[model samples]
Target chain A: MPSWPTLRLRRQSAPAAPDKPLATVETQHGQRRLAAVCPRAAAMGLRVDMALAEARAICPELTVVEADPEADRAALAALAAWCERYTPLAAPDPPDGLFLDIAGCAHLFGTEAALAEDLSLRLQRNGLAHRIAVAGTAGAAWALARSATAGAPCTVLPAGAERQALAMLPVALLRLDARMVAGLRRVGLKRIGELARQPRAELSARFGPLPVLRLDQAYGAAEAAIAWPRPPAPWAERLAFAEPIGTPEDLSRALAELARRLCARLEAGQRGGHRFAASFLRVDGQRPAIAIATALPLHDAERIAKLLGEKLDTVAPGFGIDAMVLEAEETAPLRPPQAALADLGKPQDTELAAAIDQLANRLGSARLWRAAPHASHVPERTVRRLPPLAARPAWESDPAVERPIRLLRRPEPIEATALVPDDPPILFRWRGALHRVRAATGPERIAAEWWRRTPQEQRPETDLVRDYYRVEDNNGARFWIFRAGLEGMPRWFLHGLFG
Target chain B: MPAPASLAVLRARLHALQPQAGHGVLPFGDPRVDACLPEGGLALGALHEVGAAGIEAETGAVAAGFIACLLARLPGIKPLFWIAPACDLHAPGLLAYGLDPGRLVLVQTRDDAETLAAMEAVLREGAATAVVAEAGRLGRIASRRLQLACLKRGTTGFVLRRWPHGRTAAVQEATAAVTRWQVAPAPSTAAHREPGPPRWRVELAHARGGIEGAWIMQAGGSSDAAHPLRVVAELADAAPAPAVRPGRAG
Candidate 1:
């Protein structure tokens, strides 16, 4: 197997001053200790895990700062995302590292050594102190990139040589806990080579399976998968420009070309994308991306370009973009268009789908929908919003009952006067206008759905009963008003409007 | 060339240029109302405007019902697009006007610009049989664009002039609509002291090449029956009150 593993280690420098010896200290058990030290501090004999007071005495010029592990992790993750320009399988390995699975991608950069050199050169240009190592296994590359035995900043171990390369490294490089390393050292096994020479059954029986599993992983006898930060898209197309382009026209032209290529691939596989995302990688390391979703699966290049073009203005080309990547984040199977046996001159389904896609992309998908009838007695709960293209559910309105043409989002409270307790209001004041009822329809009692009510709403005093009335005012404007509660003074509310 | 012969040739050329002239018309199924229109029906592949009259303009309930009835009268089972600034239309209520709720694609846009844009897009797609949009104001240029889009796809478009709550400024701007209507709720004739079928005082304020008229129209007979909005009586245009006012006993 052609196994290619890439390991990246970044040594964070103090942001204040690079020349001043700096040490980040953290409180542990009521005593502050050095969590990390800069290169200048290390050269001045200040070490991590040393007491902050002792370090200050050893190097009085040492600049002390509080350690922020969370920010460091977030910055590492962002760097990993930026590294996707090289390979989509780049993942953050936490605290201060990244793992890039560039197995088949090395040829694009000429060779494995050249790819590592390019990566390190870019890191150096960005003023980051980093070490990169390539090996046949992730465990071996990770160990070699951090160990002092590599002798060089960038190391490339050929395939099948991980066993020999990792033998001379200390047991600590096996990714074992500090207690386990100390225990192994007490047993006279200070190096991985000595541990490999010992009987595996005896070593595992003493230290459990962790040591054996990690040792096997480093020697390429087992596998270690990097936990990717983001799931790789099923289909993606990337373009790198010889000269950076920053104009809107150039960006849109590039996007259209990428979309055309992506759609062609989707067509060949008999699939359509439901969601597409385009990422523009700027020279200054800013990755601005825009995404669009369709209501129906589509593989049409022009349609995808049109939808994405509307959002091109939102992408800011900071210092010009050097590369671009388009990915189909979601896809589904769709057969190519075929001639129907009988064309009835009706608009094809795709025409509606295209219109829906355009509107949804611009105004948001939630804004467009088809109303479906829900099986509930409550006026508001009786209707449900469904996706525009969803299959229409069966709906049958009861002609015997009258429903208002316009239902208010919320019922507005009104003052009313009635002759009887259960009778319709003779006069009602709504929105500061009094309407004398000329004609009326009876009390259509719609009770609250007991089964759907929550525990807090099930109280007796909360009265969810309503008696609705269809009343026509003297001006001929009809309204659907209701009285809440079954007892005491009736509370009236105007719920809907009728023609 | 003879004068009569030359005039006939020019008329034919004009008709040929107007695409909607060949698309036919949408009849209200009532002869009295259809007679006021030049083509004996509302022109297809054109834009129409409907606004609520007087105090009823605030809610726009009556105007929405009139539009729903017109959409129901359209021939075919094709889907209808309804674009509005807010989604307050109760689907169940539309059934009363003979419009099936299942045949509706409702789009709630953020503002007037989005509503008009969505309407134009839907009309140009030619997938929907008709499109109804509730916008507070319609400029002349925007309405002309909507009409042109309809002409391209032979889709009918209706713009309902509606404003937000408590803001009842009337829309006075002229548009390129083939017909303009003002609908007000009229008192229904009481049947045994109960409210009968809803009535509307519908006024055809403008028609492209037809005479303007006003009528007191009642919406259908039975709830299940497809009552093609029948006219009860024609108004004098100057009269404020009809003869069928219910007595206020309270």
Candidate 2:
């Protein structure tokens, strides 16, 4: 196995267990003893340095863990996922430090201390080695964590007491290299307070400028930041279950609540999010979330629920989820509904959306898309998918030019026998049946979009330039056909038929 | 002298949505056929047709064929619907009769039973001016139910018959229709001057509103290229017994 770069857990192993084979290291009792004799002692009295065999002589039973730096990192990642339920800002405790900004939520649980206690308790239950500290400044919190009395929370040093609060901590807590710490210790620097008192230039010259700068952050003398996990996105609404949800119905009910809340929030802000993300936070500390992204922004709760329902199959609530949260991402200007009472008397947007939503559920979402014209002549690029959250648009407008009422996404190729290079072919075969062209229109030319294309565009995958024609066969049947690439020799494909 | 108020009121209510009252109001396949329909036109909802005709036996496409000819002359942009449960309605054939595809909606369904029901539903609530469903003979109750539906919606209901195995549950047994025509093969077209596909020869087996029997007329076509896919319908007074028999061998 490849050994990865890791934080050294300890200098040596602890004493061995009396009952089990694996050995352990000694703690502050300072004498070697079997780990089985008192495992609790290993947690407390064991020193960071003590060879395994030497400690085994004092206590025979000890359990040793071959250090797993990788697992530790993964566990921290899982912790991050768990934290995502609370806020979008959950991240790894970088190099063994977790910084959380629970600013507006302090009063939600009564006080910052209560929030910390709740957070610490949850972490403990999930088997995490965590200690939380909150202060007016990031610097104060960082300094207080390693400096405060053991087993106690952060010491909230008064505004001027930053230097005093940091004074007693060992220089090891200053986050410097061992060589620098040893060098500082050898030169009569006893405590962090002593280092703080040294002349600025002298310390910079003697121990280097980095340590002094870090010290400033520790003492709240300089501004510090707790880098958030991911950027706090647009809108998020959370639902706390009075009774935890285990059934899909329960989850759906929770979704309705979140949709209403989120929609209202969007309405109040006069905005709407194009994407709706619903997260089900599992009791096992694993969050499985599913999101539906619309091509448009809408706040209709029923529509939102339907879109989310389209994706509900992806969420497997293993055992059960204790809470559910919904977040809206990528917001846009909210549209005031213009549908009149005349429309309400008939089938409305809600009904249409519901019907389309049902069909969309049966057919895959990708299969359900409406297209509108774009500013491109490249036929494929000339149309784009209308956003799902948007209302249906009118089909006809002023005719700047004649356009086909029917258009096919992909032109179906015809099996050709009679070859005509210059003009529309007199006969074409489709669906194994022959159609003889009787009346025909022009071989209209459309050039390639050269300016908007790249090197890859030079070689079209199908490599055909198209000149379209409206042809009525001998049978009075109308067909939309095309001859490829206008400027030169073109191929043919039967595109569509007028219905 | 003005008609009495009570008498005028009686006449209006009696014929409200009555197809007989609307005769001569609109054009159908000759006024004779139009007078027979309750709506005096194709029932506007959804119409279904099932073809049991072979190229040698031209009568199979008769019901659908008749409707197509009638609808071809329909004016305005009102859309028409034609549904078939048997997958036998040909699109090109419809276009041959001059029914505009833009204004005509075609739907293929599973079987006569489903198609009949679907067509009935569409007729009840849709914009189709005609509802035609094909079934093996429709039972009296079924015909009455369909008739009531058409009457309420001001639609024309045509229960196009298919060859049933037994004493059918057909509209013939269900109600005395305004007109019931027996359609069969006619002689080859003198214009085409070749052995060609069978053409229909129609005979009026029953008619309450028009001549009971008449000369069978040729079904017409407009030749762009002269599709040559034609069916001839000439009216006759009392069709041959076997011709009117439900599903009897020709």
lDDT of each: 0.83, 0.55
Residue B117 of candidate 1: its Cα lDDT?
90
- Over B1-250, each residue of candidate 2 has an lDDT whose tens digit, in order, gives 4579878888888877454333122334454444443445333422222223322122235555655655655443334445444433433344445544344444445556655555555455534455456566555555555655655555555556764223333234535334555554344333322212224445555543333343343444344422223323434444343334453211
lDDT of 1 by residue, A355-424 (tens): 8888898898898889999888789888999998887656785779779999988888999999998989
Clashing residue pairs, backbone N/CA/C < 3 A, model 1: none
Best by TM-score: 1
Model 1: per-residue lDDT, tens digit, B152-201? 88888999998887887754988998889999999999776578889999
- Return the top candidate by DockQ: 1
TM-score of each: 0.87, 0.54
Q: Chain A TM-scores, all candidates?
A: 0.86, 0.64
Which tens-of-lDDT digit does each residue in A421-466 have in candidate 2?
A: 7666778887556887665666666666667565765765334457
Clashes per candidate, residues 3 or more apart or on different chains: 0, 54
Residue A104 error, candidate 2, Å: 4.9
- Model 2: CA > 4 A from native: A1-71, A84-89, A102-163, A177-183, A199-213, A294-296, A335-499, B1-250
DockQ for model 1 equals 0.56
